[model samples]
Target: MQYYARIDRSCIRPAKDRQVTKRTAAEMDISSSIDNETTHKARSEGATRLNSLVASIYIFRLLFLAVCAAVRIQLDNGRYLVVFKGYPFYEKRAVRKGTAVICSCTRAQCNSYIHVDRDLNVVHEEIHHSHEPTRLIPLSNGRYCRSSNLPQMEFIEMANGKVCLYIDRYTFYQRSPRVWYCTNNVKCRSYTALSPDMRPLRMKIDHCHPPPKLLLNIFMTQRGKERLVYHDYTYYKQSRTRNGFRWGCTKNRWHRCKAYLHLADDLTIVRSNMEHTHSPHGTPLYK
Candidate 1:
């Protein structure tokens, strides 16, 4: 004998109800996907805005730096001078009802001028320069000053008894009574002016080439005599020839050194035998 169990039809869910529940879950998934897409789009837009802001700030900084480098102010002789592009300009007068100031180039021969507002902004300018830009040198006090104030020129005596002006390691020969031009005049435009008492007044332009290597010089002895200076050696006039003069090393009398050289009339080395019996004098220059 077997017993049969009966099922309640009201307790089981219908097919229509099950399909409605599945549709509700699918709708929630779609809504969540839309929300995620919106969040991603917002983040991307925020990143773009931040990059644009950073770029704008960098450009502003570069503009400010360019302006600063283009203009400079300096105090000269209790007066203010405007230094623009390495050229100094003096205040000539005020124009535009005192709203703008007219500045002329400090160099007397230069006719360049500029009109600047009260805030040092250039309004009008004429950039015709007759000379090269002024050169500035750094001072010990961390300030920059004109190189004209410091006249540290050196005088060099050549082997031919001619004097040359040495400044900043470049050699300049005398062109006139008061002017000295660079040795390499064809390629270099550097020159130096002198005062009445043989003092350096001003120097113009920079050297376009390297300094020349000087291996020979002439030195004056204590007894009003001249000596030919070689590398760490002093030579005395031994004999006079038809073409040139012969020089023997000064150590010949003491150490029997046989170093000798023949110099032409133009003070050029014609022949030389630099073998010495002893060590060199070891002096850079003879007094």
Candidate 2:
């Protein structure tokens, strides 16, 4: 009875293992099919979105180009003026005031417009012209004229805030070759031409010979030996006396302090201490 039971149990084990293997294989197939379907759906959705975005962009670009084609620009007077579609009133006022204004302009409108009048009309019959004559000012770069014939030019404001002409040149004025004779002294002549803007050039003491240099001299004695110091308005570069003594950077140079000496350095104490001890002015020394 035991041998028969063992043979039946062994036969049942093989059948059960085969059924488990079949179930696992079927589950794997179903999972793979679901994953494939999900991947296909995701890819289709992504493609549709991408196509829609590209189509929208194309439409927007086309609309923008069409709008741009409808707008144009125009010039008025000497200034290049443009007719603004939106806020037309503001733009007109800005143009009249010579102020900058922005307007919605398009490329097609820009090309379609043509300049009717090349010349600027100041008034009807008077034909308002530039009152100032064309001035040819020599520049470091080259010669330039106030007329529009020059390559680079611009409107400049004067000190009074009035309109003036400006050129894109380095130096505007040149050294006039004409020699101006001094009315006071016929012998004297000047090469530097003063501007017409200032008062008439007058003969001054500086025009004399010896070109005004600092008298670097020193003095020791009080009589005829006293050095005549020719000092201009500038304090630092003052001419020194001839008697081997003058106002130097240090107090050691001046034998007698012409002015009240400030105690600037330790060396300044030399003269002060000696003057105090000896009573140099014959005044009674302070106790």
Candidate 3:
């Protein structure tokens, strides 16, 4: 005698495939909140594991996970976690992007990072760090912990949990008069704008500027022919000059605009002529 069992079709569905209900703006009681919570090591470990598991998923859902006041938003373009201000870390969201997101650590010296699309797919990743990562300093203003030798922007967590930019003596003196950028090197199509007062502004300031367009391979250009046109002058062929590297736009790669930049050793664009093809409507520039 053969026995038959009715099977549930949804039992094998992916964990990320479940429906995610997004709370309305009014639902979050933490609009401009000051997160005073300290994440226990266990919670941090949970977040770390959650991040790793999400990174392994092929298809992602619109997900939101909050661990110790830090919010993680999984979008169609990338997976981003917010290390809100006033905490030990300061992470913001990467608006939607169309291009494949790659790790920002460009130098041959850097390698242990991954870039995931909003759908949580690992589009590009690498592990090139030749040295131990910087220790997590208690209440430090810098974002990523690093033994970085780059001239990068350091934003300070405010009393209200928002952030304002901070430029140390080395960075300020090294790249004076240059506007700062929050790009993941020149590898991804995500950029954050900062106000003159060093306030990290939303990319939608006046008009939405497209993200930097180029790969880290440009650093390995053998011919030395790759150049960027900034201020009507084409430059950015120099490497190993600053504490980091610098480059200009590939003539608004796939767009009609002129913008350029200088990056720090930490792979952050220090200065540029901010112009883009879209407004801050919260949409990806490309699909």
Name the best candidate (by TM-score).
1
Model 2, span 180-205: residue lDDT tens: 22222334332123235421122111
User: What TM-score do all the candidates reach, one by one?
Assistant: 0.38, 0.23, 0.17
TM-score, structure 3 vs. true: 0.17
After superposition, candidate 3 runs with Cα above 4 Å error: 1-99, 106-108, 111-113, 119-121, 138-287
TM-score of 2: 0.23
Worst 10 residues of 3 by lDDT: 166-175
Q: What do the candidate models score in CA lDDT, each in turn?
A: 0.75, 0.31, 0.38
Give the best candidate by lDDT: 1
Each prediction's number of clashing residue pairs: 0, 12, 14
Error of 3 at 103 (Å): 1.4
Find the 10 residues in a row with the least total lDDT in model 1: 278-287
Candidate 1 lDDT score relative to the true structure: 0.75
lDDT of 3 at 168: 24
